[model samples]
Target: MTHWRKRYHFLVQITAFSLVLYSCDVTKPYANKQTVPDHLYGDAAADANANMAVLSWKEIFKDPLLQDLIAEGIENNLDLKTAAANLKAAEANFVQSKQAFLPSLSGNASAGAYHPSDAQASNTQVYQLYALSSWQADIWGKLRSTKRSMYASYLASEAYQQAVKTQLVANIAVTYYQLLAYDEQLNIVQQSLEVYSKDTETMKILKNSDVVTGAAVVQSAANYYAVKSTVPDIKNNIRQAENTMSLLLGRTPGPVKRDSLFNEQVYSELSTGLPVQLLANRPDVKQAELQLRSYFEQVNVAETSFYPALTITGQAGLYGTQLKNFFSAGAFLANIVGGLTQPIFNNGLNKQKLKIAQANYEASEYNYSKVLLTAGQEVSNALYQYQMVDEKAQSRQEQIANLEKAVHFTKELLKYTSDTNYTDVLTSEQSLLSARQSAITDKLQQLQAVVNLYAALGGGWK
Candidate 1:
């Protein structure tokens, strides 16, 4: 009795010691250490809460065909599917981590016979069946920290998937806009071809009548060929744009149906909200922060690995020489054990693990900060580009109008007066063509700018 009492007292003392260490072994809560600037959008923004990203992608794109393309890309883009697979994998790992808190049980049964070579030796047979269970107590919070890390990783994967979706939508819209621009440019080139062909014939008639020299006829023919040469290149551009949009939609390379560039309705209010909204709006930004969170939990896990672990194990079985007596009380056997294991030396492995985890945590901090800054840069750049293109629209239209008049005036002078020669008419006609094509390009830029701004503000993937 005295011996049993002493053993119980020793166990009580050990339990008390473990309880005292519990406070220090508790895992720390995660905190957001990243900072946001007062003005993330720079000087290009107006309202504090007018972000266009809050609107659905349909609201911004407005074209039925474009909305269909975005929906198709979101459903079929390979990269987004891959991200989704990764998210599922992370979720599985998180579930496994949670299961670690439960005990494990195993069962086994065996029958064996032993025979000796000597004549006097007799054969012996034994039969036994047993069940065993073991559980590790989370005395140092290591399991808890690991579970938290896996949870963070799962969230990061979800955010990464969203980021891919947002990017894919933007790419499809931009490529479609480029196709429309190419179509419009092709039309302008064909119109100029018609005008130049007429001028070429006019030059020949005037030369035969001696109103203008052969040089005028040669110049008109050269300009006609010059304008005709661009058709193939513009058609090639349209084909390439179509192929790109096809890939985005996960389809074979083919023509993409689209509306006219001039028909696109421009959203008057491109409201970029405050910079701080990026935390909630940008999936890539959220992904980076979640990665940082996972690494923080990993650091905690590493810290806890330096402490001791508590474990409990038990087993119960039936043992008897004869199979018929296996159910007897005398054949029953049972045992249990409880202990603690502390790592005293492991060739500096624990210290190395801690150092690596710390380094990873520090690196994630810098990466998270970099992602946040890049998000702000994208928003600012898109907003500025949209404004720049909008401002240029008026001037570009005026310039095209003036060049058309110049072409008309110069052609009339060449026909009725000697003040302007063939060279002046050719120059004015070339400028008019260039300006018309540039006007189409300007509209394309404006439309793409809005798409970019919407994406930069994390508009898609709702």
Candidate 2:
């Protein structure tokens, strides 16, 4: 057969094979068949339109100081910076993956001398320069599947970066609030310590008048020192909390200035959107979904490998013994070759790889489902915590008010009647002190609950 006719027949055969491979999709098509629960918060209907996570950090965190802190954390936090670097690397890899279907060209130059085996022949010199290129036809969408997998992985990395940013903002806010709470607790202890000091002095005077025994004086002094000792501990907690905030800011250990806990305000009511919204709002959940897509694409890629790989390679260049004739047509050498490689006997390597790919895909499926469940659980836990804290706040306030009245009434009654003793005064003071401390803790826990709920709802990452 003539060369031209042979080339035409090869082209027709390649075209037909390409069409056949493209038409048959052996890999199972991926579908998101995950079953979302009826409602995330166990409600009959979902508030699909209402979404709290959509609100920016500035909107949810009312304090300007915390807002500034969050902004700083987003920019300066080392974890965020690392995540950004990973995202950039993933983006570059994805871009590189896109060039898989494109031909790769390489150049080479060589100069060598061939020695004659017989003594009568002279050594000959040869020089050659060549450009070589190769390309694999993505007849079965193998390159496309690999590219898609990399793209999904890149998206997952980006979503993971957002998740890191969200966590950083929450950490900074929580740490800053804890500092404020510790400061308030310290103030309470200080004020109570002074009052106890005065009571101890009164006890001494009563002991000198024989109105109270030695045990009362000792007990009053002990109570005063107990509150006094808490002062240093609370102050230490405040300093440690400040250090933690500084760490979140990616700065050296230092003080974090902020508003008082009482002044720190968050959104009154959280608007959690539909359960489906978590797939979009929560970065972790979104990342898991993307990971599942990436692994699925990998399975497709692995499956495609079971078929023959069609590659076309070519090289053309000049070669000559004499430098003068190197560029002439007589020195030119050119060839193009097309080949198909089938893994007829690979010792089960391909099958093992396919099995691994399928297993990884199944693992990703489990991860995506687990992440969805975990998201719902987190939101539910935070919601219940916020509700419980809010419910107790009122009762806690009432307890504080009644305790204050009891302390005042007991102290006043002690001076007016003999039946009221030093023990009664000590007990009232102890109860009042405990209630006051608890009030500060209650405020702190309530604030922490709000912070947690906001974070669980995928807030602060916007």
Candidate of highest TM-score = 2
**Pairs of residues clashing in candidate 2:** none
Provide the lowest-lDDT 10-residue window in model 2.
Answer: 38-47
Q: List the residue pairs that clash in candidate 1.
A: none
**What's model 1's TM-score?**
0.93
The segments of candidate 2 whose C-alpha lies over 4 angstroms from its true place after superposition are 1-20, 119-121
Candidate 2 lDDT score relative to the true structure: 0.82
Compose the digit string of candidate 1's lDDT tens values, residues 214-317.
99999999999988999999999999999999899988998788999899987768887877788898899999999999999999998887887887677889
lDDT of 1 at 429: 91
The C-alpha lDDT values of all candidates are 0.87, 0.82
Clashes of 2: 0
lDDT of model 2, residue 204: 90
If scored against the real structure, what TM-score would every candidate get?
A: 0.93, 0.94
